[model samples]
Target: MRNFLVSSLILGSSLVALNTNAAGTDSTTFQVKITVNESCKFTNAQDVNFDAIDRSTGKQNTATGQLDITCTLGTPYKIALNGNGKMSNASNSGSTIAYNLFQDAQYSQAWDKSNTLANTGSGNSQALTVYAKLTGENNVEAGNYLDTVTATVTY
Candidate 1:
């Protein structure tokens, strides 16, 4: 009976040791991360159309148009116009009408490739206005004059 009791006590002590070691824990750490890139695009662009002008009136013709742009937040961009600053006659290529594009209503700042409009993006669609004026000339041909202006956004 004494030997049996000692054996039982040793088994109980081994079980307790195993339970204590099982309760302890160890761990290692890892990382989570991401990367974002800058981007920009043109949402919309409207044509600038001037009202029919009667050359005999001898007055400058004016018009306004809009451009919409969307870009990543806090991105800096430049808007430029790529036109020759002249409207060629569709019927007669030799004849041309002189015109100019402005960034303001008062036609003070020129909006062209050389003179670009700089702005920052708000992560939403932004509307920009293009102001244009046709120089009044007494000898302009009596017909429909047209011009194509391309708007470019540089980030």
Candidate 2:
């Protein structure tokens, strides 16, 4: 009975040392693989920023353009807002802008020779101008006529 028990113990110890589960997970085959994907990129067509360098400001103007205004009693005030956007594609590239003005309003007359701003690649400057007039009575009040100009750029 002692011999049989000793033989059974040896058989159980050999089975535990073989350990087939450990060998199954060993990385001997080394089947290495990699997957990659690439997508396209585009040049962003964003608009340019516009600003005027001047003394007359909201706190401002043009290819040195001027917003000249004239007003008189019993006569409509005639005013014009003028400016030019002469940005290059290299110095300031791929950007476009426009201009608008408060031409004709209460007690006023207005005008604009160049209305829309077109995108040009010829290195030529784009000019913009708007006209306005204001009608006044004999007692037309006068001071510093001011307005707000907005320039919006999008990317």
Candidate 3:
């Protein structure tokens, strides 16, 4: 009887150990990390130069400015554009100095309202994505092309 009991105890202990190890091995951990990395490469075809020219006036307006960004490879990014008239000595009136800013001439891609959510955000640097294919074309005009592009930011 003593011998049988001892053997049964050993077998039971061995079985419990095997089950515990198996369970532990099959168990897995799922983790997600949200870290935003911004790699910006802005390329504005219009090289703006604020030249205060001397004309018939004291304050000569010499602002032919443009802004663009080219950044293509990263996690999916969101894009957005700054408001118009942000450059005209911003004041209480909430207006712009430039004439055609924040107009339709600034966008390269126009996604549907639902589809556009991917490239829009409420943050600085405003999500300007770098497309892998378009970046290689080098088709960006050499001269001063007036456009107001929204930035893209991806994860």
Candidate 4:
């Protein structure tokens, strides 16, 4: 009887030790995180072409162009135009014609470095129209007059 009791106590202790090791559990937590930065880019910029302007007509020459931009969703952005606001003659650099850029067809809301167009991004391409006009007084020597305007986007 004494040997059987000793054997039972040892077996019970072994089983308890096994259960304590198997049933015990511990846990910890780690972090999962990410950050999205505001971003913007110009997808396309079309040239503002004033084709065959007849200076003799004594009328304001107008042209329309476009700029396509894509940006992060819900990001606010501003677009500014930077240029000399004049189209220089290729043959004669001294001979130039002054022009104006506007945000509207009515020649209102001048678009320049100071005055910018503001909007919210939709994570897709957005089209913005650029209106350009040359007054009728630009009677200078005009043989392939050209100008470059940079569009800067700020988010």
Tell me, by lDDT, which candidate is best.
4
Error of 2 at 1 (Å): 99
Q: Decide which is better by TM-score, 3 or 4.
A: 4
- Which digits, one per residue and each the tens of the lDDT, describe model 1 over residues 100-141? 999999999999999999999999999999999986463667
Task: Estimate the Cα RMSD of every predicted model relative to the unseen true structure.
Answer: 4.1, 20.1, 14.0, 4.2
Error of 4 at 60 (Å): 0.9
Candidate 1 stretches with Cα past 4 Å from truth are 1-26, 136-138
State each candidate's clash count.
0, 17, 17, 0
**Each prediction's TM-score against the native?**
0.79, 0.21, 0.23, 0.80
Error of 1 at 101 (Å): 0.6
Return the candidate ranking by TM-score, descending.
Answer: 4, 1, 3, 2
lDDT for model 4 comes to 0.89
List the pairs of residues colliding in candidate 4.
none
Relative to the true structure, candidate 2 reaches a TM of 0.21
Task: Tell me the RMSD of model 2 versus the true structure.
Answer: 20.1
lDDT of 3 by residue, 1-155 (tens): 99999999999999999998888445678999886655545454353344432233334233333435444444344444432322332232332233222212333443322234243223333322222111112222223322243534343
Score candidate 3 by TM-score against the native. 0.23
- Residue range 63-144, candidate 2, lDDT tens digits: 1122212222222222222334222223333332223333333313233333322222222222323332222221212222
Q: Model 1, residue 73: displacement in angstroms?
A: 1.1
Give the winner by lDDT: 1 or 3: 1
